[model samples]
Target: MDLELRHMRYVLVLAEELHFTRAAARLGLAQSALSAQLGRLERHLEVQLFERSPRSVTLTPAGEELVARAGRLLADADDIERQLRTLSRQPTAPRGLRIVAETIHPEVVNALAQRHPGMAVTLRHDTAEDGMAALAANTADVCHGWDLPSVPLRMRSGIAQATLVDEPMWAVLPEDHPLAGEEQISLAQLRTAAWVSPGPGTRRARHLLSVCQAAGFTPDIRYVVDDQEMVRTLLANGCCVDLAPPRHLPEQGCRAVRLVEDVRARLFYAWRRDSVPGWLAREILEESRDAFVAGLVRRGPLYARLVEQEPARFGPLLDIDPAGWPAARIPVPALVSTA
Candidate 1:
């Protein structure tokens, strides 16, 4: 009979065990059966594969060579089997997409579910830098975050990006603070006041420094914290003031006042080059924009007052005219308290 994979496996096991009974047990066969099979295989090739004595068994020189070759052959065969299994599943398996971002609104997730019901979508929270790294490693399909000019050129290369919103930044102040009553605050007016900045060495920190410098004074940053709740606590306690975008809804103890300076924060949707199709990327961008607008509209009277008071600044956000600003097509659910 022609040799088969089973025969190679048999010889390899026997060579390692060096005992017919032990090798047979390992192979889940009776000792007599293993011996008979090997004997037939040897007779077919006219070779003595093993030297046997009543006390012990050892491999012949021919057996040694055969075992070495069998090891490599078995490895290759196993690899082929694994590859074939993977190929077999490709046709039937559903596609999966992963998005890395600081936050993903529930509305966006629901919209994607309605658009591509079969595609599985996973959301993970990470900084913009780490999110881009995930995209480069092919572990994530997209990233959503601020697009600041301070980001490294190396990180920007080989990535496709779409800008979702470009809006003015706002000053986050304690409700009891002196400047908090103002509808708009200038950076220069608060240059001497204590400030809460993000962690040093981060892109946000650098951007804050640059914006402060443009207003003619370095920020007197008294606290460096990254957690939003902690920052809000500090502001609520009247410890310091911070800058945030309009999308960052004001909390109970804080107010979001528009900055007099023209400084703006840009929101971006990004993906690796050729990793996501152009059409799919655009769909995500559009969905994200709509969800963001819906959130602003749902921010209650505080934002509504801003839209009414500063029509030139906040009016474009709610413009429903088809030619001016695109309104959300997806249904906006009732406002849920994030507090």
Candidate 2:
């Protein structure tokens, strides 16, 4: 039997609550009915996903994995439903654009709205990986994020991407940290420092790994996290160091220093081929470039120096070649973008 979306949802709720009674109540089903449905689901998959006792409930290892997969599946399903609903509306009605981004400046969103009075834009924030997944699944029309020379995002097949801004990565150190006063810091200089980073195997994590390996030492990752704020907090406390482009400098209690290495971060937007309207897409690209560049140049100090040093490099952008996608790019002046 094919597993249904509803069955996955049932499993998700049960996994979260870890109790049949609570999950059933939340789903508006009786305890017995919920149990019967779970039994059918288990038989269909031929796997016992949960271990239950009179006293408590817990997931089997397989259950744990399914819970994670279910979340992505459900999100994609919801995205598809939303897109269908929007498409089913009057063809001449003002169309809505759903954007999933790790970080999109407010000025860009405001500018897009101002430029296209008829377009409805929705911004949803998520991790870069999840945002790309949404774009791939057709839940979102576009995703905005940064692609670094060290950590290029893995684009899903068939997606077309355009670069908007290029900026340089910086070492984020405690305000009083020894290297904090330096205008630039070398990767080798940071080799011995404790680091906080994204989880292993993620594109960003892998990039950091490669960077460290090239620097002749491994990063002593003291914390594995997905939250940028947590990384900043750890760095500010003098516990560890993290990296960001100059545009995404730590908000407080840390200093940003340019890296001597040529690692660059390119701000980019990816969408399904032929999904976005030509006018709106071009407007988005233009506004993204303007807003990003304007912010960096206005932010002063590091921003001014970077633009002054590499103006041509930040001008007009290019798309990732579909054949090699993120791994291959047509050579141009290298650029890095801030958040």
Candidate 3:
């Protein structure tokens, strides 16, 4: 006989509630019955899933893995059933779209909602790992992340991608530093400065290392931080020399100078290749791309203002490479967007 969904549900509820009595009540079953169901599941799977004491029950490592996988399975099952019921009522078009990004452009959200009033759009903030996980589990139709994976460790195979931006590198320095006095810095001069970075595995790391190689010397890294805001604070306080987009320059205390060469990073939008964007989803993707570019343009004024402060040393305008963008761009309608 095949394993039924009841066993999965039993495990999920137990994992959620933690206590046997509470989980049993939530599942509308007796404590003894729930316990028996869990035990049967454990035996069938040939794994110990729980570590229970009198006061509490916690999932073992194996159990934690099972619960995460099972939770996604349950959610997908529910969505499929709900979609079928919705289809029975009206088969005209898709009712909603789902998207997840690290930081969303507000204009993109507004334009998508206004342009397709019939389509409901849901947004979630995600990390690179979270976005990758969402795509793999089919929880999200698409995601944007900094790094593209070579193996199918998490994400499914055959996901198509579109690059959106080549965020140019800038050298963040203290106001008092001697190099800060220069109008245009040479690569040799910049490499000698201490570096602040996110560490070696990240795209930023790759860019930072590449910057040093081009400059003819490796840098002495003084600090590491993942948060961009924190990086600015560290640079301002003299923790380490910072490198990032010109926009990431600390507003008040520190300054940023655009590197001379192609010292930059890329951001991309990726989706399952064989999958098609459902209703207004395709339009939403296009709107997002436009908003991101427009935001960069809007920041040009900011760069200009920084130029006044330092005069000759202020950074250059970061440019987007069209070739790095999606191979198959979404077709936008002739309608003028309100965003």
Candidate 4:
């Protein structure tokens, strides 16, 4: 009682072939079945769609009209089916893990790659504020940076954080500076030294200012540079001194002297509460912590001495057990003495 797509196909095929046996062969049906199906279609529509003779098959005027409409309908149906198949065959875009950090460690990234081979990973360096904003906006999955308690509660509402490491803030001075030779220097001793710090209004800059004020002298900030290399250049040229953690101190041009006051900076791994799965977040945090400690272990004598002499200060890193680290991957020499 109702028309179907098969009826349209049958009508068009028979019309094109003009022979029941030939049309049925092309349609992969028995000739009798094709004829019976056509009869059913005509009866349903209450009209003959084909004229037949012993010697030939021909389209009736009704058949001609029906075939004209059926051809268009069948063409549209085929096109839709083709489009659907093409869409089905196309692969969906791969899920990506985007990370923002102040410093990207290759070992951490490589560990992530090994753990999630199918996942696409990307890392970029950005300020802590921007990194937090990216996590809130769903543009980033994770962020590695200094923990700032001064961040407003609203900005941190849906963010989860884990402490990665607490590194002591060292005085990065020119290798030949007057106080560079001191095993430990007090902040008061550097009161007259010109300072190179991050740009004004940044969280780091604000923290630096507060730290200096607490240390009993306002630092005469002579140079404001955000790039680490440029900051190193300024220090290397003996233009200014700056505070940095062991990992951030320049290897070639600066001497990192321990602060006598034991000032420390806590590095954090942060992410939106809902951005990553719980297991993945834990894995990333663990891997980041391990990589950071392993890097310190491989950072030559200074950090080795810190780890060796001040195991209490670095208890968390020691808990992870650097002795378990693969010797081939990260060559860590015995921490016998300070450089």
Best by TM-score: 4
In model 1, which runs have C-alpha deviations exceeding 4 angstroms? 1-94, 150-157, 300-339
lDDT per prediction? 0.76, 0.75, 0.65, 0.77
**Displacement of the residue 78 alpha carbon in candidate 3, Å:** 43
TM-score of each: 0.61, 0.61, 0.52, 0.64
- Name the weakest run of 10 consecutive residues (lDDT summed) in model 4: 330-339
lDDT tens digits by residue: candidate 3, 16-135: 889999999999999999998888888888999999899889999999999998989989999999999997975243466566776667778678667668867677877656776777
Give per-residue lDDT, candidate 2, residue 191: 82
On TM-score, the stronger of 1 and 4 is 4
Model 2: residue 278 alpha-carbon error in angstroms = 1.8
Ranking of candidates on TM-score, top first = 4, 1, 2, 3
Better of 2 and 4 by TM-score: 4
Model 2, 137-250: lDDT tens digits are 888888888676766677777677777667667787888888989988898998888888898887778878888788788989989988877776787678888877765665
Tell me how far the alpha carbon of residue 336 in candidate 4 is from the true structure, in angstroms, after superposition. Answer: 35
lDDT of 2 at 254: 78
Q: Where in model 2 is the C-alpha error above 4 Å?
A: 1-94, 114-118, 154-158, 297-300, 317-339
Tens digit of per-residue lDDT, candidate 1, span 188-284:
9889889998899888888889988989999999999998778878987888988887556446677777787877766667786556666567667
